[model samples]
Target: MNDQRPIVIIVFVFIISAVLLTKLFMIQVLDDSFLKRAERNAIQRVVDHPYRGLVYDRNGKLLVYNNPIFDLMIVPKEFQVKDTTRFLEIFGITKEHLIETYQAARKYSYVKPSTFIKQISTNEFARIQDFLIDYPGLFIMTRSVRSYPEPVAAHALGYIGEISGRQLERDSSGYYVQGDYVGLSGMERYYEDQMRGKKGVKYKMVNVRGVDKGPFKDGEYDTASVAGKNINSSIDMELQKYGEMLMKGKTGSVVAIEPKTGEILSMISAPFYDPNSLTGSDFGKSYTALNRLETKPLFNRPIMATYPPGSIFKIVQSLIGLQEGVLTPETTFACNRSLVACHNHPSPVNLFGAIRNSCNPYYHQAFRQIINQEVSSNTYKDTEIGLDIWREHVMKFGLGGTLGIDMPNEKGGDVPSSKYYDRFYGNGRWKYSTIYSLSIGQGELLVTPVQMANLAAIFANKGYYYTPHLIRAIDGDQSKIPQEYLTKHDVGVDAHHFDMVQDAMVQALFGTAQRALMKDIQIAGKTGTAQNPHGEDHSVFIAFAPKDNPKIAIAVYVENAGWGGRAAASMASLMIEKYLKDSVSRSDLEKYVIEGKFMN
Candidate 1:
């Protein structure tokens, strides 16, 4: 029994020694976590941020570029300020702010680095860089902020900001860190992946004073950052400047598009702030102030604000009426005020004259014929079926749905369908008489300014359009623009029908829209006065030039600006003349629009 016990003890000791030896081998050879931790004590990882992409206009004029800035980073465990008051004064930060920032960094990570002070300008960095070495654990990391040379196109260009928690969670690639800058809106947000480029890193050696001591291990672990690809936009900067000038002191938007390419020439939303105001260290304060304003300067009205089409919708009704065989160009309707309210015009006007005169009763009579096609014995059933078909045709014009423009937060204006009405008034409960308000572009029909511009393009192109887009090329490659923008979308109407409608739109300038006419150039246009329950009627206009081969199509809207012929048409005319002739001959019209006197 004593011999067996000695053998058992020896075996137990052998097993314990083997386990210790294996663990020691693993810690020394296979595992590098402990080694990395020790290395981190002397070597700091510095992020090399890439420069954001540059933006240029169609004319090759520089629009957006980057300016170098510095971020003061902090590693909490290594951070120490011997003179707290001096540190606070040097940074221009309150003591409370310093403590709060440090506490937040510690909560994030004790050993890892975080931004202590963000977006110090080059001049500011030069003034404060000498003092940074006085405090341990603080280092300067160079970064960039966007700079706009011109203050135009703020909404179209957008802005960049620090990565939000929500954005970080949604990032599947895991490319972004907490302090990383990301595109927040507009083109900046839409093309973020292409414009962000790749970030690189370097293992930088530093002493206890937090001063950089050259590359660690001769930069064996360093990577080179690739600069972001540049973007060439389709905007005509001169025209954009002109449109913004015309829209100044007004509460509206203007969107101009080239008819052949669907490239956006200019997009202007009034009451916009300078793009420079939203850059650099003051972005937070500037944004807060802008967001608090009642005018909402940040709102991208061209694609976001929705309005009724008013009389300009009569042109669509005329084309649809011709396609459905419900009315001919020669068909006449009496100027009856009993059907719906309309301004004084010729009685018993034909389709051409109805469009020229914007006769509301003509559309009211035509809408009834289109909706009551005798498809069903029951009048209500016939109306329901007819409305569904009519909606299908209207959607082809890019109404009641998003045009899929390369912008974020675009609102697809409402085009209430049979189901939309059924939810309110039950199925088969509403008839042609109940929904007659839609005949004149009122009721539930709504459209964005960009959509209205596209409608003008459709008329100019004689039945089809391309999706509107702001980007023309990426990094000098034109093919990089989305395929959808290059494709044609036909609106189902025959080309001949558009010709007749085009003639009537030309005549409209001599009829109700005389204010939009130019002496030297032949212009085709339609005016609208949308009913606004909150205020006066909203003035609206859509137009294209040269009568035969159109170059540009534009839509303008001015809130509470009385008649469309007075305010909206004038602005659109000036824009057209400026684009086509490269100069405007109508300074009188320009002065009238710029003075903001049309609201009276």
Candidate 2:
């Protein structure tokens, strides 16, 4: 019985030892995945943002660059604010700021690091570094902020700001987080991807003190950030600066373009605010001040503000008249001061003479003839082909639609069609006589400063123009304007018709804008004093010079500047001479435009 009892005890002890070993093996091997995940929770991954791209003018002048900025970051779980008062005094912040920052960090997650203070300048960074040792959980990180060197072109270059919540949900590659910056307007918004570089990640092993000890697993997962692509703008810095100077204290816009390439040399929208004002810490206050100003400095008048083309549009009417074969160069029409008289003189004026005199009656007659011919034509009797033809010709010139420029927020000026007329005056009731105002570029015919400038470009090129653009290239690649834009568009008129029209424009310079003419240069231009609904006439001028081999084409509009030849014409001529001849011919004219004050 004693031998049997010893054998039973041995067997029970062996079984108990075997069960303990099996359990130990399961914990070490089978549960390894769970333990590994727990370790990863303690180690956090952080993204490092790369520097934004630089912007340069056509002549290689730096428009925008980056400046180093310091940001104070906090890891809420590790933060121990010892002596809160002293910490506040050192950082030059209130206790509320610290509490708010801590709360934000906690909301993001106690394990994640968050920004507490951002955009500390170099001087502020120097002062903070001296006392950084006192703060354990807080650390300084280096980042880059945009810096405008020229301080002009604010609207064109645009501004960058923090991304909104809506942007994050839509683009969830983690491309943007809570505080990521994005372009808000102009070329910046149009080319965000090229300007914002890719973000890089580093898995860091941080200690309980929030100190980055080293990379987790020796940085096998770290990615290097790519720098953003640089942009080369088509804007000529000198010309842009000069144009802005000319537009000082005025509410207007001036757009200058190279006829052949369609590169915008200068685009000035008056009442402009300094771009540097919207950058850095004072942005909120500065933005409020600008918004409250009576003059809306933020408005981009070149592409956004639509106005009547005025007498400059008479050129289009004349071309259309000649193209439709309703009027010949020798066709004569008389003009008197009477509003009701169609022809008041026995002496007949040719096309060149009529344009030189700006005879409204001649265009009225020609437009009526065109309408009657189209409505009575054999192809489609009663089909209003003349109005359709006119609409087609205008649309071919890039009117009535967006110009597809690189800038954001361009408004397409309205160009009414035959259908629009039909809507206004029931079918077949409204004739060319009912809408005679169209002959003078009034009524519903609206165009922008950019469009007018492009009109001048088309005439200068003898019938075609490239798409006007501000940025010339991205990283040295030329623009992608279509070949059709470079090719001439026949306005259904003979080349000889252009010669007559060109002669008339030249005569206009000799007649009304004679005071603006230079001694050595020949400038072909047209002056327009468009009647305004709000107040006095709006002075406008469109010109291209040397006349023979046109170089710079420009359009200028001055609100309430009175006579087109006096204010807008003088300014346009001065700019043209300054660009082509590199100097002004009339010192009195220059002083008048520079000092002329108009009541807005």
TM-score list, all predictions: 0.94, 0.89
The segments of candidate 2 whose C-alpha lies over 4 angstroms from its true place after superposition are: 1-44, 130-133, 172-174, 340-348, 377-385, 479-496, 583-585, 598-600
Candidate number of the best TM-score: 1
Residue-by-residue lDDT tens digits, candidate 1, 235-347: 99899889888887788889999999999999999877899999999999999999999999999999999998888888888888899889898899898999888888879
In Å, residue 134's CA in model 2 sits off its true spot by: 4.0
Instruction: For candidate 1, report its TM-score.
Output: 0.94
Query: lDDT of each structure?
Result: 0.91, 0.79
Q: Tens digits of per-residue lDDT for model 2 on 1-600?
A: 987998999999999988988877877787787677766655767777888888889889998888888778887766787798888888899988888889989999786678889778899999888676566667776677788877778778888877788887888576888777788887778778888988888777766555667888899999978888888887877777776777788888898988878888888888787888877767668888988888999888998999988888888888877877877789876664353233233335677777776667777666667666745644232435677777787877778887877788999998888788778877777766666777777888888999999988877777777888877778877644334334444444555667778778888887667766777877778888787989988989998887888899999999888777877888888888778766666778777887865432
Candidate 1's C-alpha lDDT? 0.91
Overlapping backbone residue pairs in candidate 1 total: 0
